[model samples]
Target chain A: MARTIIPFGPQHPVLPEPLHLKLVCEDEIVKEAIPALGYVHRGLEKLAEIRDFNQMIQVVERVCGICSMLHSQCYCQGIEEMMGVEIPERAKYLRTVWSELHRMHSHLLWLGLFADAFGFESLFMQFWRIRERIMDLNEATAGSRVIVSVNVVGGVRQDLTPEQCSWILTEVAQAGKEIKAIQSTMLSDYTVCKRTKGVAALTKEQAYELGAAGPTLRASGVAQDMRQLKYAAFDKIDFEPVVEYDGDCYARGVVRFREALQSIDIIRAAISGMPQGDISVPVKGNPEGEIITRVEQPRGECMYYMKGNGTKFLERVRIRTPTFANVPPLIAFMPGLELADVPVAVLSIDPCISCTER
Target chain B: MIENMKEITLDAVVGEASKMKSDGQRLVALSCTQLDADNFDIIYTFDKELVLTNFRVTVPKGSDCPSISGIYFAALLVENEIQDQFGIMFNGLVLDFGRTLYLDEEITTIPMCNNTKAMTVKK
Candidate 1:
């Protein structure tokens, strides 16, 4: 048997972002895959040195458009810990509400992209249609659809009043019902299950050893979610990580589908138990020490390590994105998969190249 | 939480990493911060049972730091990345891109280092 190398994409119909995979194949079976990134490497960490801490919030938020809110939230959390400022109670509740809404929209976006990857056009359209409602809510509340710059150092910039909260709750509930109606088809449809089930499977031990995070780790039955750290109002709210034991593509899909619905429930809970107070507090000085803040993003566990030097600028800002940790596992799973199944396995982890290269 | 961080020597990093691996701790992240022109601090974070333990090691410029990728294979990406962006040398990476993981050969200056010239802003 002879091995032939095939380049899988900096541009492909299935991938919305740039990720090049060099696949060594014997006929249609892949023997190895070597990934080449940096196509969209903007060097945001280096830029953090030039920009002050306040401006770096906007830069970090641009790390990934899909999970921009979480990126800023994680940065703000790190800064708040270093500055030693307690945000208002109302701010915590608002953060929780927006975080869940971000999760819902992100999962829906991934689901739509995953459907498109598998050639299920109608499913793609349906998922994106439901996702638009969340986007509209974001625009209405946060003033932006994708990169909502709502998170500030002390607290969030915007607040939702009672009328707006009611509207959001209604919208999320309707989205939940619609998602449930399509859940069986997305999970159990003959084409979807056949393409996804038992593909790119990783055991619990493998997932932990390989440093897999987020839904990818959850689908492998690891039950490790950074939300358990309870950074925001998660400690006050009732929550359990969504986990699936199978560790296959289908299991990952099931986890995200369930998580979207869970986000809806969480938003409702947080809004009903809303606290009355101010949304932000005044910050006096610069962050002087170092801290590591972890947030569970739509993809997985995103870690931010910030070291400050008692100035307006941070000495260092290192972001360990979920996609960066998830890439190695994707490489490990690729060697044993068929050439045709490569796209399915690749999309299973929901690779965000921008996040990986940022 | 600061008490949980254990500062270790560069020579002891490999041994300590192996112990954490045996204890079923996941490697949360690895970060490098430039201390000055001649020194850098490399921090390795690990998690188990929702508790974090950080191990720190300080190394001089151009020193060959022992790679923990052998114990935690996922360290390969971050190690390769640090090698590319910070010009830090890790002795034993499973997959060494030879400092081409994120940057090209034509770009010689390490972008993340303290002394590198700032990237020009296009007006």
Candidate 2:
């Protein structure tokens, strides 16, 4: 037996983050892999102990730039459950709209990153160009491109007027048309098919037993989305979980692509069905109970367990991030792939390092 | 989808809790806090999703709560954390543990609690 070691990141040019992967290869085939984290541990969880409950929403948003809105929403929902406060219908719709927008942008960002990973610079640029439209909508709606600090404990701080809501709906519709074209190109593109087809395949049983969630599990043909539980006015609005079979890299890519389109549809429905009500609801009394909250983020399902003991600060905050649940399954996927395809194979799972390290 | 997931409460299993040893269960986190001057509350989350239903057990102050670390793998770490932060004690947990969230070796008692005072000394 022969072995060789290869280091792949912590400052790699291609990867956007400092995700370092040490690969043990045997003749261009990876046999074992080890992922080294803690590069961006900014003590987000530890900061929760000091930051006020209202301020921790912003702190948790900083946990991951790509999925900031969902992070804040999850944190806020947990606090809301502890306080037993119900948000207004209009605020719920606004949250659903922004959440869908964030999902679209995040999936498109991941799609571009995956394209660039396979050295398809042209496809990458195309996907990113469309992503710019969604970013513009985010900035116009929430006053920030990435970290949209609209979520509070009970409701959203930002309210969408009729004009702003219409403008977002029109722009999102146009973006949806552009995404359809991009999807057609992606599905038929020969290079993408050749590189990703049948690579890093995981069986349905393996996906479920390892606790993989969101698109990864959806790609394996499991319709297990937390949103299906009708969270955040989703029961009022109409939407469906996008799923695909095959459970390969191509299948994961297609699932995300289709989800990006579905998010646009969900946003359109939310904006069109935007009801009339107050945006922010005041929370009273100290939180003094234990509640479990789950939300479907772009990556997968994120759960927060919060316990409050009738104080301004919480007694304990436990986060089960999607990446942490996905890591074990990702490690299980790396054993039987060629060395050259490792990066794309890992990217197929959409590893959010900050979420995992948090 | 698996519907009607079975649930077991912590209050019912308080006395005869040794039945956990026959199962491959482990502790995920043990959190504690002083809710008021009269009583303190401690919570233990177990990794029961695989073998049993994952449940959180709450123990109030002055009660001889049973320690489940002997049957669980990571219960000792969580026990040490609760002891370090809330000044609570587990009868036989391995102590003198390294700090996971705090820097000072001698610091104990919940830092986030309203009762704990901030110490400031001139360098």
Candidate 3:
């Protein structure tokens, strides 16, 4: 039997990541997928050698604009731990509030794109419309929509006022209700289920061994989430990893959909239990030695490895993004998939090539 | 700092990774940092029950570290990226990108290594 090698994309209709997959196929079914990345490689990690450590905070935020807050939060947390800076309690809650907002918007953005990937234009618009309200909240409260630059080494740079917090609560409550209205359409509709259910199914063992993270791992029933590490005000809130036993594309969709609504509750908790204190503290010295910090980003567990030499410049800053960790799992299950199913399956990982190549 | 990190020689990578696998650890991330012009510290992070166990292997520049892809299978992509970035090669890589994972054939400067310019295509 002869095998045909087909190029999937360096350009796709949807997905923020530009991935090129050389799909080896026997007729319509794929046998292996060899990925070619670096189309979006920015070498942001190497900036650590030149840029000052504090300046790198801004640099890391640009790694992935959608989850920029989580990126900076993870990086700053590692530096804070190294410098022994205990942030203010209010700062912790503020950070958690913004992180969940970013998570909700990120998940909604992904859901819209996922729907559009399969030609559900109407559903796409609905998800994005709901997402706009979250964006409005971010811009109104934090002064920006996409890359909310609220995180600093000691604490956050911005604080939510009483009226702003009240507005946010109202907005998110409405957003959660809107998400509930479309829950059946996104999850159980004939069109969505036909394309996603049982497509590119990955078992629990494969997902774990291949190093899947975030919802990709959770959708497979691993029950693992980096938020369990209790960074920020997550310790003060009640949370659980959303698990789906099917481990298919639809399960991945449900996890993100439910997480968007869950993000609403998390934001509510953070706002309600938030203490009154300073938003930031004074930092004394440079971070010395190496430390690794992990955070639950919209995609998955984002790890930051920072090494300081008692200087403004860090020796190295290695970022192992969720998409980077999730790629192997995506490739693991790609071999047995239909060529037509490749796009939906790849989008399922919520591939962020910039984060991966950075 | 690095907790639960056992220092090992380069050749012991596969053996240590195999042991971690048998213990039911998930291969999380492999971070490679240049110590100097001479060596790189390879940190293998594994998670079991949400607890991280790490193994550090210090390999001299241009040395061949045994590939853990055979054991973890997830080590393939990171191994290739390390191969491209630091100019360190992995023995028995499941899919060796031959230092072209991110770099083109024309630009040869090792990007992650110090004192060498990370070459980009003239666009």
The C-alpha local distance difference test score for the whole of candidate 2 amounts to 0.73
Candidates sorted by lDDT, best first: 1, 3, 2
Tell me the lDDT of candidate 1. 0.91
DockQ, model 2, C-alpha based: 0.09
How many times do residue backbones clash in model 3? 0
* TM-score for all models, in order of appearance: 0.97, 0.80, 0.97
Best by DockQ: 3
Off by over 4 Å in 2: B1-53, B57-123
In order, the interface RMSDs are 1.4, 7.4, 0.9
- Candidate 2, residues A157-178, lDDT tens digits: the string is 9998889888887888888888
Per-chain TM-score of chain A in candidate 3 equals 0.98
Native-referenced TM-scores of chain A, all candidate models? 0.99, 0.98, 0.98
Candidate 1 residue A254 Cα shift, in angstroms, is: 0.3
> What docking tier does model 1 reach?
medium
Q: Rank the candidates by DockQ, best first.
A: 3, 1, 2
Which portions of model 1 show Cα errors greater than 4 Å?
B1-3, B116-123
DockQ of 1: 0.64
